[model samples]
Target: MKFDVVIGNPPYNKGMDLDFVDLGYKISNKYTVMITPAKWQTTADDYSGCASKNINYKQFREMYVPHMSYVCFYPQSMEVFDIYQIDGNYREY
Candidate 1:
């Protein structure tokens, strides 16, 4: 499914990696709003979406809060790509 805007809270907490959920929302490149931990900033390198050295990505904006969740806005253009996580989950990022 294609979309211009995406807004929602994916499954968070309970040992969920917010980055995975963020990447899952790759279907919406123009804009995305998600309430999640700010931990995703440090995991940018871990995302397969950054595999290409030439890909330019804008830093995600979020209100930094550890224990408390923060809403994040990622208004960046990304080339849709696919990868198979070792856990057998297929994702498009």
Candidate 2:
């Protein structure tokens, strides 16, 4: 059975990563949209800065997880941003 509406208070725990979830949402529904933590959607080369040089929203949206419908969370502080942004690069390995 398919429901017409769905709802929930999705978690944003420290250990939780929203990238996989965001991609799932996009692939699950062509009309779906969400305001996720800015970092997960777009960040610098080392996963730093306001806007990333490598990572992008399009990449996040490309993840394939059909069960994920929506997301709710807040961005990490600028201090955390500092950790990711080193020497003008986002170094996520």
lDDT of 2 by residue, 1-93 (tens): 323332322343321335334433435424444333444444433432223333344454454324345554544435443435344344554
Model 1 worst lDDT window (10 residues): 55-64
Cα RMSD for predicted model 1 = 12.6
What tens digits encode model 1's per-residue C-alpha lDDT throughout 1-93? 868876665553322534444454567756666554343555543355432242212233232123224444543212222433334244555
Worst 10 residues of 2 by lDDT: 6-15
Give candidate 2 regions above 4 Å deviation: 1-9, 14-17, 48-58, 61-93
| Each prediction's whole-model lDDT (CA) | 0.43, 0.39
lDDT of 2 at 46: 42
For every model shown, the clashing-pair count is: 0, 7
TM-score of each: 0.34, 0.28
lDDT of 1 at 62: 35
